[model samples]
Target chain A: MIKANKIEKTYSKTAILTPVLNDITLSIQKGEYVAIMGTSGSGKSTLMYILGCLDKPTKGELELDGVDVYGMDDDALSALRNKKIGFVFQQFFLLERTTALDNVLLPLIYANKYPDDALQRGRKVLAQVGLEDRVEYLANELSGGQQQRVAIARALINDPDVIFADEPTGNLDSQSTAEILDILGHLHQEGRTIIIVTHDRTVANHAQRILELKDGRIAEIKNP
Target chain B: MTRTIRIARESVRMMGRNKFRVFIMMLGIAVGVASLTLMMCVSKGAYERVMDTVNRQGPDLLQIRPGTDIQTGLPSGSREVVSLIEEDVSAILQHVGNIRAAAPVKDRKEIEVIYEDKFTLTRIFGVIPVWAQIRDFGPREGEFISEEDISFAARMCLIGQTVKKNLFGDLEPIGRTIRINNVPFTIKGELQWKGISSAGRDRDNRIVIPITTYTRRLFRDMHLTQIVITVEDTKKLNKTIKDVRTVLRDQHKITSGEPDDFAMRTPQDLIDLAYGTSRSLINLLTGIAAVSLLVAGIVIMNVMLASIAARKSEIGIRRAVGARKNDILKQFLIEGLIVSLFGGLMGMFLGMGGSVILSSLDVTASKITPLAIAAAILTCGLIAVVFGIFPAKKAANQNPIDTLKV
Candidate 1:
């Protein structure tokens, strides 16, 4: 479950304020599959970031699973993200020169639980992403598609309640993109809330609901 | 606790990745610690060496020599005149309660010694029979001069290594006759091989004869060249010195406020003087070594700053994965500690090796103490922590969102 009330974000430079998000309010029930779709500068990624508790909003109330995340300190916010939300980035954001298994173990480092069993869980998650054979390969040794799979495995390692994937297919071939989309669809079916931020209409089609953002505000919500 | 280990393991892996850069940084610290250790080794070793020589002779021995004017401390102009006599020595030995033995000595430099065709010029010293035990110069072969030799003014003497080498030329000089200043004397014994003194003087280049023989047959004067006083108790040396001065002053007929015509030096005095000189030398060397550590610290800081700049993305990724600011700080700090600690250990070994080589070469009597090694390591660790803070703080405070944008 996630909620936002009139969320606003702005960047200030040399006494000039530029708003990135304005008066956007939304909510999603538990285990719902949703997509935030927009072109560049449409604030769709910003909204997703705020909802994932990675960045704070200038004006709004944000709640994740009945907890007021905005009121928590940096440590508490990080703990919430480690437990309740996982992120997949456009660049994959996997640590270079690190093994796939170790990358998958990243979230567990901050999860503050099951330290001894983290390796076993990381191996299981890598296997779930069909990367068990490639778990020992470094990020630099993997294909773009395989790297994205490793990032996905890392996201799944914590078993978070929600997943935020930003342009997950932006740098992939059509075949790899389809593979990633199928994984997302399967995860959604498993009753985990999914929010994908992307500009591709085809990518948005995999979700049950699509919220189109324009000019830093939510312009329309369509069920497909 | 396991998490902490994970973080340390990651840091070690990171350092491994940057092998060349890390080695250069560690080398800088290593040189600094090495210099620190070497300096301490040299000074401490030299100090121990001097004390060893002093203790070997006798800790309570005092040597008195005539100098200057009887009433003034100022030196009487050239062509020196001796004022101390056998009477002054006997007075100190009688009236000075703590004096165990006071042997009056008479010595002359450039005395020609000849054994058949072999000949050389050396110092000839005359002392009472008891002086042999007091100076720790008792003959290692044959025998020292006897009381019978002193009273009879017999032509018997003990030769040192240098004099033996020049006059005897590998021949057994004991029981052999040698001519000193054209006067024939039988060699009764040979002295031990005493090394050079701290003042850089040869210690085994003289021959000893009885004082009675020296006064009657050579100089024919009662005035003594020096007085070697051995105290009954070493702890009471200061009191003995004061009493000796009182007796000497009364014998020489000097009044209050008048400077004595003689100077006195004890084994303790030599030790204090040696320590004072070595301390200054050590301080100067230590100061120079400390500067090296400071320079290494600066170099480490620069390297760490560049590393922080290069790892921005890595920092962002770790932050995204739940690494707190303190975690990042600790990682870098631990990285610094690892480098410095290893460098310090390597430096200690290098320093110890260097000191051994130096001691062998006779450049310095150098040795490394355990405390010095521990201290050198601790200093390097502290230096790392001190210099690492700035870069570690910068790494910890970076904006993860901005870093990710890169």
Candidate 2:
């Protein structure tokens, strides 16, 4: 469901160009649970961002679910993201002042065909993540583990096919990290393709396949 | 729900979070709209006042008072020279065209009048019987000063309603004798109720006597105070005034270089004089309203720009959640529009309250009309749209990736 052909990303300053991702090529099938692992400067986050359709590569082609991603305009690109992809960040990235239910329902705002039962759908997702009682709690008022759970619910709101978890447990305690991995594992079992980016080996072992990056290139690929 | 209302609800929630910023925005627009409302109120009130004066004095009536230097257009005070007389009245009537009727009048205030044991200080007007026709007033009881009264110089008088109330109480005043300046004169008529004059004085507080009797018996002066003339063609007053001026100048033998020894006045002149100060005041308010709105618009722009800059994270998050650039634009624009609309209403109420107090104090007159309300709202809308664009555009153009990374 996801493919990249020779993807390259570079940052150009006044007179210097620094490469962030170089000659990246990969593919993942439907319902696949994959993990990209790297150290701080290994460009694993950059690769995940590219795969998540949040950024365009300077030189490459990307296809998500048979659609040429970069060829579309900004509006179409945004619509594609809302319909087919969900992102869970290290910071959780929930709107700070709003309730967990409001954050869970965020993706539906841009869904084009807003469901008549959008609130009910949001509540169902929150309940799926063991947050039925925390739905009315504000994001700032939630614990780190609970905030991550709310974000996971937000990702599931639009029922997207591809889920990207970039350092999803980076800021959480060990218990919260385990909770997030379990939720991602459940989503994968439900036929959603799951991609996790992390620097830790323990987290990578949870994925069915692991791709390790070094100096902006794929150095090793192994099945766990 | 419609897109506008949805965006407005979100915008309102955002604005409600910052109380002081919203207040500052509201204050500027409120002051500007308040001044705009006040300007309209005063102008409308002043116009109505001038028309009232014109209606009361009779549109076709003009007066020639014994004054030469009436540079201010007032027919009294130090400019009066007492050079006009009964003969000049005849000359102008016979010579000036468009003469409907003419009457000579001499008046004196603060005369002690006695009726039995009751006495009051009253004003006395010495006028011919034709004064009744010229002034469009006549006694409701008894008779006006007649031709015989003018020819014989009889000591006959007409008492006004105020005089009757003061001296006679419920007693009948017609045919009763009253002592004016120690001279006994029979009250031949009781005048009708004329209400209050435009000058804020009681109109029915004086007595009218024959001009012949007034000149010989009471005033002891051959010179008349004024000649009241009603023109046949109301539209031809200017030309008639010019003709009368020429006749007076020729009869008095005043050279072209010398100013005439009499002053002319018309209802139109009174209207013009009444508006002189009010027109300038209205213009000053217009300038204030314009400048206030301009400054307020600029302030709104600067505040909005600063707010958009500070709200970068919020903008990015909204964009990330599927909001289009145009959606952000609509949101902020709706926010400013709501603020301005409320500010305008607040200002309107404040202005109305202010006008009521000012009018009650007998200062400048003011009335809030429908046009004033419409103008206030329209101006607020225009200012909001004009000043709200840059900030909304900046907000819409914010990059979700860059902001989210921070």
Candidate 3:
């Protein structure tokens, strides 16, 4: 479902060039649940970003479902992300004043062809995440776990092929983390590819495969 | 179309994020539009009032006054000018092509007249019978001074409304005798109410007598203060004016290139003279409209910039969710437009309501025209597009990664 070949990422500030990711290569099959584990400054998040099509690699080939992901233009890449990738960040990034249902419907708004039953689909997704009762509650009014669920519902509204959760449980309580991980696991079981980024070994153990990164390169891969 | 509606809905949602920010943005446009509408209404009303005043003097009417060729200024406190005379009036009346009627006038300002041991100071004008029709002032009751009165130099007169009130005081004015400079003249008519003139002087505080009697018995001169002429076709007034000037110069024996000792005016010239005195007030109104709109534009732009600065992360979130740069641009631009449109509508009502209130209070003449309404509305849209661009650009050009970092 995904392939990366010799991926490299470098950030330049004036004359100084800082390498973040160096000669990284990896692949994950369809329906696989993978976790990228690293400590601070391990470049695990950078690798996830490149793989998720949110950031372009400095020098690399990335293929998702046989398409050259990095070869597309900015608008095409945005459309690709809208159609193929779902993201759950630690911040939630939901519009604070909007309702949970509205938050879930956001990505669908940017869809090239909006579905006529968009509102119905949005409600269904919110129901799937057990947020049906809180559909009318504003994002700020919801608890941390509830807000993350709303974010997940947003990520799932477009029915994307891959879900990227970057430290998704970092801001949540333990119970909320278990609930969110269970939802991610359920999404993977439903034949969607899930790539999770975390420094917690226990979180990595929940995945079918774990890729460990050290100093900008993949240090080890543990198969399920 | 659905996408457009979705984005428009998003823009509205963006506006509702901060009520204070939206209000701040609206204030300038509202105030600007209100002042602009008011200025236009005042200007339109002032113009209409000027035309009414000028039309009262008669659009086809022309005046040749004794002077050294100045176009404006009332020839008051006169009898010094000997250049314009009865013979010039006769020549112009006979020779001018479009002349419908003509009358010679001689006036003395602030003259005291007596009635039955009571006296009031008023202006005295001596004119022929045709002056009534040519100048549009005639008897409201009784008969005007006739040609027999002029030819026979009869001691006959017409008393104006103010004169009747002051000198006669509810008594029958017609057939009564009043003394001008101690000379007696029988009242032939009671003239209509003339009201105050554009110069703010009481127009009805004057009396009229036969020009023959004026020259023969009153001011004792063949010299005329002015000659009033009405034309058959007002559209040919310019050609008629040229003809009158030529006839007057010929009668006065003035050569070409030598300035005639007379001034001439049409209703247009009178309107210009009236507006000249009020030009400063008009300019001040215009300046208010301009400055307020400019301030409004600046305030709107700055407030939008500040609002964008506060909503930077919101823009980043929109971008991360797959909104293109153009989507961000269209969103913010529509937000500005919506706010400005609301403000403009509010101001339109305010300005029109203000004009009605002002007119009702007699503060100033004011008229509301559709053009003013259209201008106010279209200007709001234009302001949004003009002032909304830079801030929207700044929002669209922001780096999403940096904004979403935390």
Candidate 4:
């Protein structure tokens, strides 16, 4: 479960204040698959970032599983991000010049919990993303679609409770996009909560419910 | 993998990514450490050499030389002033408690000697029979001078290797006669070949004659230039020195607080002086080398800072995964230590090789010790930590959100 109360994010430039996200409240139940749809400058990406714990909200009271995340320090927040949440950026932010298996193993490395079967765990995650044969391929050597799958496998390495995907299929072909959606649907069927932020209508259609954002505010919610 | 091993592995991987830069940084540290190590070797080698030479003269040996201010007991002013007299030698032998043997020495340099058709310039030492026992020198063949030779002012002398080579060539010179200052003297024996003395001066290039013969036949002077004393017991050296000084002061009729115009030096004193001189020389050279090491440390810092800049994206990715700021800090610091340690090891080999080459050339003695190498490596590690912390801290403090955005 996730909750945000009156979240606000602002950027200051030369003594001028600019608000990227205005006061808004939202909550999502466990196992819910939701999509936030917005055009450029609509603050959907900003909301996703705050919810993913990548950045703190300027004014907010965010709670995850009844724990106040904003009240914790940077180290504790990083640990929470490691064990609970996974993120996939639009650009497939996998480490370049490294093998896909190593990319997936990144979270395990930082978590300092390399089980005796850590390598096997990494391999299994890559297999789930349909990259079992490309585990040893470097990011640069892989196709765009393959790289995105590798990034997804990395996000799933920690077995997070919630997956946050920001335009996961933005740079993929239609065939690759369908494959990614099928993987997401399978993950959602496993009872894991999923949230997707995208400007593409077809991508939003894959979610169980949709929320439309406009000008830094949530305008409408629909079950589609 | 263990946390430390993982961090070290990552650090090594980063260095491998920038091999040329790492190499340059290591070269800088190596040169600095090499020079420092070389300085230590040279100083140690020179000190040991001097100790060897001084020890040859025996440990409890003492020499009383003129114009060495009695106040400080050090050589002072002009040594041309011969203040010690023959009476001081006799008085010291009589009054000193730990007396072994005493000899009065008078020497003149560049003295011309002629033998048949050959002639050469050499030093002449006029000493009593006891001088042989006091200075650790005796006839290599035949015999040294005797009291009878001094009592009658006998025209008998002992020739050193150099003197014998010049005056007799291959012929035996034991009974040969040579003229010194137009006076005839027979060579009673040949002194041994003692290669070189302090300061690389020839040790076997002089002739020894009786003190009476020297004063009566050659340069007529009653004042002795030096009084060589050998103490019987090592523990009584100081007491013997004080007793000798007391006799000389009393013979000169000087009251308390007046300079004795003479100074006593033991072999240990010379050893200390030699060691101090070498230590200062080593310090000066090492100080110069340390400046370059400081520059190298700065260069390491600059390279690490540049690396942080170049790896911003990687840093952000790691942070997003779960790495804390402390992890980033530790990674960079370990990288610095690895670089410095490698450089230091190479530098140690470089310095050791240099010392070996230098020693072989016989320019100056050089010795490498294990302790010095360890010290140099430890210093390199310290330099790495000192210079590596700033950039590492900067990297650690970088905000993940900002870095990710970029």
lDDT of 3 by residue, A106-197 (tens): 88778898898988999999998999999999999999999999999999999999999988998999999999999998898899899999
Give lDDT per model, in order: 0.84, 0.85, 0.86, 0.84
Using lDDT, give the best candidate's number: 3
Task: Give the higher-TM-score candidate: 1 or 2.
Answer: 1
* Per-residue C-alpha lDDT of model 4 across residues B178-291, encoded as one tens digit per residue: 999889999999998888765456878899999999999898977777789888898887777788888988987879998877777877676765565467767776886788
Best by TM-score, which number? 3
Off by over 4 Å in 4: A8-24, A37-49, A57-59, A167-186, A199-205, A209-220, B57-64, B67-80, B90-102, B115-117, B169-177, B229-284
Ranking by DockQ: 3, 4, 1, 2
Model 2: CAPRI class: acceptable
- Which parts of model 2 are misplaced by more than 4 Å? A1-64, A69-71, A194-224, B2-5, B12-39, B68-75, B78-80, B83-102, B116-120, B133-137, B194-202, B230-260, B272-307, B360-364
Whole-model alpha-carbon lDDT for candidate 3? 0.86
Interface RMSD of each: 1.8, 2.2, 1.4, 1.6
Chain A alone, TM-score for each of the models?
Answer: 0.97, 0.97, 0.98, 0.96
Error of 3 at A203 (Å): 3.6
Distance (Å) between predicted and true CA of A117, model 2? 1.9
Q: Could you tell which candidate, 2 or 3, scores higher by DockQ?
A: 3
Q: How well is candidate 1 docked (DockQ)?
A: 0.42
Model 2 agreement with the true structure over A30-50: per-residue lDDT tens digits: 999999999987888778877
